[model samples]
Target chain A: MARSLTKAYERVKNIDWEPSYISAADKYVEATRFYLPKKALDPFKTFIREYFLMEREKESRHYALLEAASRLQGSNPEPRWMEGMKFALSNLSAIEYSAGRQMGRMARVVAPMELRQGYMMQVLDEMRHTQLELNALRHHMRSWQDPSGYDIALKAAGNSVGAGIFRALAEDFSTCDAVETSLGLQVLIETAYSNIFFVGLSSAAAQSGDQVMASTMLTIQSDESRHMANGYATLMTLLQDDRNIPLIQEAFDKWSWRGHMGFEVGLSLFADYFVKHKTESAREMSQRWLLDDFYGGFYKKLAKYGIKEPRWLPDVIRNSEWASHTAAVYLFGAWPVFYHRYDPIDEREMEWFEKKYPGWYSHYGKFWEAYQQMTDADAGMLVTKELGGLPAFCQVCQLPWIFPRPDASTGSTIEREGRTIAFCSPACKSIFENDPNHYSGFKTFYDLYDGWDLADVIVDLGYVREDGKTLMAQPVLEPRRMWTVDDIRRCRYEVTSPLRKTAGVSAGGSPHSAVP
Target chain B: MSTEKMWIEERDIVGVKLIAGEEAEAAAAVISESYPDAVIERYPAYLSIEAPKEVVFDLRQISERLGRPYDAPTFLVIMSSYHGRINVDDDRITLSSEIVRPE
Candidate 1:
């Protein structure tokens, strides 16, 4: 009778649930409270001492759990050579687990019920992943005296921004805007992080030959791809809203710039960290995937919504295809800060670029030189001055700041409109011209017309209420969360760009080696 | 800083408008459960969502029960999703998505 009972129980437990699926949604959400701030006190106290005390205690508890998880027997004998596995496993566990929790917070704000449930499921899966990875790392952790720096709290601050942005979209932007920014923009971010950073980290771990990282990433990314489908689906829903058409149009123009800037930052960080150790590198793939997989894919999707591509889209596309522009941008901005920690640039880096495109090296090298002169000769004045009040708006976008450029015929320049319209290259001018109503007659461009006056324009536009003395501008004019013209201009000189040429462009120019 | 030192803070939330969807709300029900001391004040969709600190949701969950994708990534694309249809006027996250579901 006992044997018969045991056999029956085993048979019942063996059923696979994948094909005949059911969502364990509540289970997923409950599991997330393990890591996430189940109560508000946690996030608000992120900068406080009690949080540190709680973290230290929590760390100790987790360490004990880690030890308990390690001693259990596995499917095979514990080998002497598997010493490093524990450390890698623990780190991966923390990273992926935190990523899942962050996804949950983000999902609560934006994702519909089904998607939110899926994210919760992902959270549960990630917990299992952490446990498994820690088991893998246990052998490695035994040899090491301390394993402190791998805490997710430290990493979460940086990565949590993605989650934070997601939450903002759910809570802040319209459903249409929220869906576009959270789903579409995040797909780009996640795709890049999975490919560039996490994949590299996984490969660097010694026992990575099982290719477990790839398998795990592939699994998570399949979900991400599905999320992309949902993003497109929500976008279709948003597009059907007549009132939101202009908002969507306006958001596309704005967020595209924001997305590109973020992409550049991510690419630069990856190049500094991962590609540093290699003879031949993944630089080309890194550059291409960001533009092609992300930006290119994004633009194609947006076009289906009756939204035309931004004029500068082509230029951003053309620039990303070559390595030279990145060289210029990095040299002036991020590269210098990065090189302080790495090996000097090797001939191998340039050789790889040349191999990818025979003349890409020589052509861009010269362009860098010219860009350097342009930057040096026109440094201070061309960029807008930082001021207290909102700066002048662009004629076209009715936003602030444009790129500054030198006239080919004469060194003399024009600063006609209040906006400091600094063109990174000449190609952008036509983009500005194409939608003059949207762009022109911003406080700056309108001033150029002989008859128009700021006072009358402001009054007619109801800059002041019925009370004439009050300069109560439209709330739109009030500062809100935006990547303003000033922000763009700041990013221009501040971030490394490929257009500018100069060796010091990035500190200690040449592709920087990786951080150990 | 002590956990005791931290005070409950109030925040506003906002969203853009859409069609077929006359209005949307992003209120959190478990405010005390989540933030023990915090007191949340609710408002119309337009004024509150954009306030300094908030935890907002799409309210899309109420529309369906199963087989929906309501994760973080989908929410990020909300702006792009509503292009051409629901105009995000000055304050409100207007609902312009045609009301296929019955009120």
Candidate 2:
């Protein structure tokens, strides 16, 4: 059993599972200190509640599988195989929870109940897949090399991937449900994966299709389709919900862009690497069939729901091709360098990219043209001061870094409302616009300094009163003084703004003014 | 004398807005070859490839021709993968997703 399993087992076993799982899940709740503590606290709490529920569901399924596998008598390969499938399903549940957590952080916050219910079903389905896959992999473990190197990287990368997603989720206080519901959750995963990776691997596992590994993926996918339907129904219902229309629109504007972009890392990487190796272009196959049948058909049906096609929909569809091309090159070229610790990108890999992804090679040529000028032979590429941190706003999406740019559209740019919002590309802009409010809510550490509210400034300056009554400002904090948005900019040293300066004296003798 | 015009059952349109590249030329050729009657219109950022009949919007092939990959999330990918444009005339269909606004 994995160390994580032992840890999880310890955690879950201690919790009383009677009445409701949420009762046990409540122990995990911890407070996050924000500048405006009450403004979005309730929503954020609700958001985390849903997150914990999903986490609990994942823990429950994992232990159940371990228990079943341990009890099974070693008889036929069938029982052993079943154990592997259970393990795979358990892992997938974890993956879904991770994905959902990231999605929430993107500010496309789903209501606690809605997210809990939807994810609960998905959690069960994913568990089913985990069990099936683990069963198959168990038999092959002795023959197969221990998958630590790549597996560890995949897990680590996958975990960090959601952090950016959560930052995006933290944006919106309302309308998270819309974002979660809009995309047919299962269909979105199935169509994207099927087009990119799932179909090819499943086809290869025909003999062992029922052996656990293959069965797990297929079973999960089958369950995913149902989840997708649920997501679709929920979205449709939400859109039609007179109370939820505006919220739905807001959620769509935020989550659609972030969610669409989220598909890039896995979808593009798998499509270019795995699909191309299968002798068919992932982009071509998906565009010709899966996307049209799933993504397209689903979008078309939205007309009846009175939901306008999302602003990002057009761009997501358009740029998917480019994303695939970039995925082929980046993962193939960069994976060996960055992701995998084995084999430098040699002539063979380059040759494979050229043959399989000729377009990416030619396009990346431009990037390298500029890159070579800055990079050294020994150090490789140098990180410049200008490239230090992501700009206050997202370049493409304009919402923030919570949303990422698509694979190939990295350098793509956009402009919004006279503000030169540089997105990694145009696709992000579409997605970003889908939920500007959510993206706008992504306050940086610097926001505390810039806000006119004296209380906000004091808290931002890292000054806290022991009694929680008064905060003293520090003079040396220059880093926090830096401001964004020329209009909202304020002085760091003193309460210079006329409104606050006058209000502070009038309201009370204390230099601190109530935050507006 | 009255002339009888032929009735068209379905005039589905497949369109692509190609970002600048060598793929621009390749996309054009593919469009011309696959969709002979396609209406090709050029813009500063992208080339709009539109056809009356269905045409495959293969990003790999297009980018292969152009030399740059579509890097970010954009409507182009979804459009290429999915079919049917937003008929702005229809107000009932909500095109909004979690992160998108309706048309």
lDDT per residue for candidate 1 within A1-516, as digits (tens), equals: 112322333353343332235354643332211122111110010112322343343234334544553554232321211222222233345545554555555455442343343344445545655554554344333433322212222232222212222222222222222334433344434443333433333233213232333233323333343334333434444455555456556555544443333333233323432333433133454443444334443444455556666544544444434322333233222111110111223356555556654554555444333323322212321111111111222232221221221111101112334332422233323434443343333233224322333333333432232334333211111123311223223323322211123542432221111100
Give the winner by lDDT.
2
DockQ of each: 0.01, 0.02
- lDDT of model number 2: 0.36
Clash count list over all predictions? 94, 110
Q: In model 2, which regions exceed 4 Å deviation?
A: A1-94, A99-119, A128-143, A150-175, A178-197, A204-213, A239-256, A328-360, A365-422, A426-516, B1-103
For residue A116, model 1's alpha carbon misses the true position, in angstroms, by: 4.2
Fnat for each predicted structure, in order: 0.00, 0.01
lDDT of 2 at A232: 47
The top-ranked prediction according to DockQ is 2
Error in Å for residue A388 of model 1: 28
